[model samples]
Target: MSLTIAVTGMNARADNPGPGLAVARCLKESALAPRVIGFGYEALDPALYHRGFVDRGYLLPYPSHGEDALLARLTELHEREHFDVLIPCLDAEMQSFARLAPTLTGMGIRTFIPNSHQLALRSKDRLPELAAATGISSPRTQAVYQANFFHTCEAQGWRYPLMVKGLFYDAKLAYNADEAVAIFHRIAGEWGVPILAQSWILGEEINLAGVGDGLGGLAGAVMMKKRALTDKGKGWAGISIHDDELLFAAKRFCEVTKWRGGLELEMLRDEQGNLHLIEINPRFPAWIYLSAGVGCNLPDLLVRLALGEQLLPTPPTPAGVLFIRYAEEAIVSLADFENITVLGETLRFGALA
Candidate 1:
């Protein structure tokens, strides 16, 4: 019970905290009983982290305040209660965690992340270019920071039906130059930065999740196609997709990044049968828990890696296993309806104990 296991960036209301909870639960179930420390704007379900995996819980206003500040408290806590590992599931925390890894090592915390330059390449409008150079295909795109470059993209044959994507948030689709300029101003006013423009290809959305060894080796891989996505368009609500093409692109992307941690690859297929890289999430996405149920156990495997163990090749994680978002509907005021849509499965794991 002396070892501490921290799963940061969790909220009590979070429907799927995925890696944070999955790894915490695995460590606890395995009798590690490491203290689980969670940080976020809101409190987490104490029953999950504090009462179970966590022995002590503290809340922070936000992670931006300080990274090591929490660690300092952990150091204080370690004087009274020791910790063995720190697992970060938040996007904001990954780069900072990686930057501080050396210091954390000296302070007795085990963690992982890509270097800053690489991390920057993974973020914002620069991602697609990096992907293309590494033999991965990205959408027909242009990132415009200067006002004059908008016309440059048009001159290069990027025309109507293009997307003006917010660097930190949403993407506004404009079918013409006028609309594109208006959307650009709106986005620039709010975000105060350049926006990424790309041809809007309406096709199936796919995500490839996996882990890599810092070197060119892979630990595990799982593929998911969107069955449903939230209307506003950040992630999928339900997904239905799987293919070797997906896996190869994911493997190649991870290999190219030299990424060492959980990664979620966002991609799209055009009408010509080309796979285009969209985005790369270096942490667990919301649906990652579904992978565990299907037999991947990425979170558990990731924890073992943090403990400095050499990773084994990932076993077949249900190649055909599928996911559906369970939703409640009201047929009428008198009765409610629940829907469960089963998709497919390569192999299924036993229910969590």
Candidate 2:
């Protein structure tokens, strides 16, 4: 009940909210009721000012700044806050945190995260291989570095109306090479990667949020079907569903990967009832707090795991739970902005150090 934990991905923008705010909200409801520290890259990340969810906020250098700078900033924050655990909620930052796990532990920061290899096995570029290993169907995917690849890809049996993707975010359906080239450059420019060209599948979307105990055991699983979507195709409203087939696929995925921590499996079900693996996200989705609402508190369970506690199998969450995304303003003082922007940190109850 006395643990202080830090969580990242605080940018709770309406169009594309991050998961940290939801994770913090879930933690606040736990019996432990730990002190929540919001860790963010941008100073104005809305969760920083959402005092109801976050007790304090600290600005950290972006993941692109490399581990040294990130470690230095975290070390300083730890010196002042003495947080007991950290739950990173952004996909792009997971690699850096996974690689720095041991170093963070050495500095008395406990984090339960999959290793880099576990993360890599389920990355977008490696989805095909993951499908093969788990005996699941996956759309053909090719990782491309240059737009020119689009010009010659059809020769390799790639078809039109393909999905153009970035390493971290952004997905567009390109009906022709020109569209493919445009999207390729746009995603590459923003996310910086070998752009992905994946065969587009026609189907309804299904999602599963599952927590792994780092030993090929699934702590809990919740399946949902989207009832509404944002313009960008993110789930805007969804309802929990009980699908044994989908749960089997998710269980197999965790078993095959020995995946640790929370992950979301995005899948598509074709008209003929064939299920295809779409994408594997390493961290919890922005809708994660829905797990808490459904009687499975994954973030709190993750904290217990990070603290070396053994876990019992989580019961199946009751189906029919629904969530609709909405927006609200977080009132903040000019002083709160100045402290985080200029000093890179701020305390809500009172100034600390």
Candidate 3:
């Protein structure tokens, strides 16, 4: 029997794409040809309808619905599909899966992911502390509970053109106090309390994606510099680069945190050529499929690790390989939508080809 695997984060909208589609694409191209199941929260997640990449698809309850609801749904799906491993590709859902990792293992569903503590340490608000512990530079930031804090922030040396960020997602640049307060409330309403106020740093963005062996070592590493961005500030086009400084920083971060599973490091490079850690995503980035093009194939390595197979260190990816994101329409009949909306699952014929 083929190895059965389920992957989440299937929303592939142009403005805000998720990492699940790229991960499934990597697994589908593997030599083993594992059976791929696309798990999504919404009925219209593009990956669910993309038959060329996803062999089967299912809809999962939102993470906000609580773990019991999610676990119950997964149990029902597992009885039919018998998935052997699950890879969560979104940051917001990582906490839920981390908490349920033991239960999943009991049900014979293996996952390679960081513990809850490791996830907490890498949150946006705690990133400054992590950087300090690792001797990496980070932008100065403050946590705010109320919008009124913006009135007095000027006295604390926080100037105009600051960044207001939510606890879970979304970041907006605020050029003035009025803008700061407005953006804070907008983010807080969606993602919740203790909004972040960060000093804006001017620099180029660099990203590193890698996997950890659950021990103190790293399994594979790939680095990229974003060449183009979407209107929502997501990297739409990027080029793989083999920079020693980037590799060293990624290795050092894994050493300090001992992070397990896939991780993406967002960094900033100033005019003087100093690198500052900006954010640490506990899971893979939307651009992770680029690893396969450059010769690393991180998602495949993650599957081996989850299955308890020993692996050698992955070689560095070749530099200058480019990945450009584009939008494509999938031809799914009305019956396909009904299957997922009403029954919550669907398996496409001839999907594995």
Candidate 4:
């Protein structure tokens, strides 16, 4: 029998799309051909209407609604879909999902995600401590509870052009106190306090996506260098690369954290050739389909691991593989829109070719 898998973060906005749709694409194209259920918070999330990518679509309560509302919704969906595995692709929802893992397991829904402690350790506010513990070099970062810190930060020896960041998402380069304060309020208003302020490092950014085997070993790893970026600084075009230092950093990270499930490591390589761990995203990045392009297929591996199957050693990822992401429109029938908006669910009969 084909496994039923549920995935979240279906929003596909051109600026900063979520990782779920790409993950769904990976799973659909995998040999298992598992049934894909796309879960989103809004009715207009484009991936829900994508014909071949999502076999079924459902709306979920916003993460702000708290875990009880989330669990109730998942339970209802489970009664209808009997999902064998779940992949949550958003950072904001990781806490709730990780906290509910045992309850989800009791309900027969398996998730391969880091536990609460692991998730907390790698969070934005805790990156400094985690880096220090693992012997990784990360820029000096601190949590700012008030926007006023931006204006007075220079007095404390923090120079201009700092990196202002939200806890779950959004990052901006603040060139001066005004820019820093503006960005701080904007991100804080949306994602809430305390916003993060980090020393800006001039460097080339590289990223790695992989699954940890929950035992100090990375199951599979794929690295990429962004060729082009969207206005929001998201990767718009990227090329896969094999860098030993980057790979070693990832291995050391896995060894130290014993992270499970999907993870994205953001790194900045300075002009001096030192790699600084910038951020640790608890879930897959939006460029995750590149994993399939390089033969790792991390989402598929995640599912297999969730199902308690042993993963074969991943082959070496070849350098030079490229992925260029583009925006496209999908025709959504009024009937489907009505189902999602009114009844909160819709099913698609289309099958992948």
Candidate 5:
């Protein structure tokens, strides 16, 4: 029998898309060809209406609603969907999902995600410590609880053009104290504090996406460098690459944390050619489809891992594989919209393929 899989992070805004739709596309194209259920917080999340990608769609309560609300909703959905596996692709929702992993397993929903402690170890505030533990270099970073810190940060040896970041998402380059304060308030208002400030390094950004086997080994890895970026600094186009240092850093990360499930490593390669670990995202990124394109197919591996199947060592991804993201309209019937807006679920009548 084909497995039913549920995935979250379905928002696909052009400026900052979520990873759910890309993950769904990967799963649909995989050999298992499982049924894909797309979960989003808003009715208008474009992925919800994409008939080609999501076999079914539903709306979920915002992560801010707390875990009890999440658990209750998942229980209700489980009775109807009978999801065999779940992949949560948003950073904000990861904590709730991680804490609820055992409960989800009890309900016959398998999730391959880091536990609460593992998640905490790679948090933005703790990146410096994690970098040091892995013998990798990271930018000098500090947590900011108030905006006033930006005004006097120069005294603490922080310079201009520093990076201002939220705990879970959003990063802005603050060129001066005023800009830093404004960014601090903006991110704090949206994602809440403590906001992060890091010494800026002039360099090109490189990223790695991989799955850890939960036993200090990496199951698969793919790396990329942004060729173009959205106004929000999200990668709009990228090319896959193979870098030994970057791969070594990822291996060290998995060895130290024994992280399970999907992870993205953001790194800055400085003019001196040294790699600085920037941020560790707890879930797959919006560009995860590139993994499938490069022949690794990490989401598929994650499903196999969740199902307790052994994974073979992934083949090396060929360099220069490119992914260019584009936005297109999904024509949706009013009935489908009403089903999600009014009843919170829409089941497409079709084969799994």
Candidate 6:
């Protein structure tokens, strides 16, 4: 019998999923061809998401907007569905999965994740610290809590044009020491805690995605650039170009971390052209399909690894492969804007092929 797997993710709502959609699609096309279930609040259309692949998709209730309701639901689902592999995605889910690994294993489901301590380093505040430890050039970074910490940042001579960020996600950038401190204090006051601080890099933004063996080895990988960013400043509205330097750097970074599962490294090529480390997203990235276009099918590799299969060794990939996201609108007056006809079609072919 084929390995039956279940991919866990939130459904799309006002917050359209960037890479999550791609991740689900990849799983749908895999050798096992596992069922994809997006567990979320009543915001996502499971039917639409499952249109092509899932044997049957489901929607589960959460305890409010938070995922505190997960452990029980996941436990119940595992018992009922009898899925061989369970992949919980998103930072929130990653956190829960790390905590629930032992429990899930006891319940007969295999999970992929890092320990909680390692996961913290993937958090926004600690990402740069991990980079520095790995000998990767990260933006100059610090964590500050109150006004005092902000004042110290300025007095200590932190570089100007800095990024002040949340522990879970990105925040705003502040120019000059004073402005940065003020923003920090304002944000901190609102939250009652410190946010992350980092020197901004003025250069090309590149992101690499891959999967790991969890035993200190690579499984699958791909590298791509941020050709064009969406309005939310999330990921590629369009992308083209791939680089080996990026692939190498990404692989080496994961090796250094001893990362055991899916990973995405967001790095910047600074003015001097150094690939300075940004953050490590140990989850599927927004444009992972772009990576598949070049031969690194992360989701497939993830499934096989989860199934305990041997992997084919991958050599350093070449540069110059290109992909661009196209959007379709009306040439003349029309009520319908068919994006599927433009960007989605080519991306789907490139991703599946």
Residues 187-226 of candidate 5 have per-residue lDDT tens digits of 9999999999999999999999999989999999999999
Q: Per-residue CA lDDT of candidate 1, range 1-353, in tens?
A: 35567676544233333345544554565534455654444432322233444444444335567876755655664454355677677665677677777877787877755667667767757766777667877776667876555656667887678888776556777877777878888888877667788778877777877776677656777787766555556444544355788788766766777778778888888777788787777777657666666677666666677788876687666545666544322121111101111111000111121
lDDT of each candidate versus the true structure: 0.62, 0.90, 0.89, 0.93, 0.93, 0.63
After superposition, candidate 2 runs with Cα above 4 Å error: 350-353
Across 1-353, the per-residue lDDT of candidate 4 in tens digits comes to: 99999999999898899999999999999998999999999998989878688989999999889999999999999999999999999999999999999999999999999999999989989899999988989998999998889889888989988999999999999899999999998998898999999999999999999998899999999999999999999999999999999999888989999999899999999999999999999999999999999988999999999999987889889999999999999787777887889988874553222
Candidate 1 shows a clash count of 13
Report the Cα lDDT for candidate 4: 0.93
Native-to-model Cα distance after best TM-score fit, residue 284 in candidate 5, in Å:
0.6
Candidate closer to the true structure by lDDT (higher is better), 1 or 2: 2
What are the per-residue Cα lDDT tens digits for candidate 3 across 1-353? 89999999999888789999999999999875899889998888989878777888999999989999999999999998899999999988999999999999999999999999989888888878998888888998778999998888999898989989887778889999999999989988888888999888888989999998888688998999999988889989999987788778888888888889999988889889999888888999999999989989999999999999989877667899999999988777777777888988764673232
RMSD to the hidden true structure, all candidates: 9.1, 1.8, 1.7, 1.7, 1.8, 7.3
Model 2 clashing residue pairs (backbone): none
Q: TM-scores of the models, in the given order? A: 0.76, 0.97, 0.97, 0.98, 0.98, 0.80
> What TM-score should be assigned to candidate 6?
0.80
TM-score of 3: 0.97
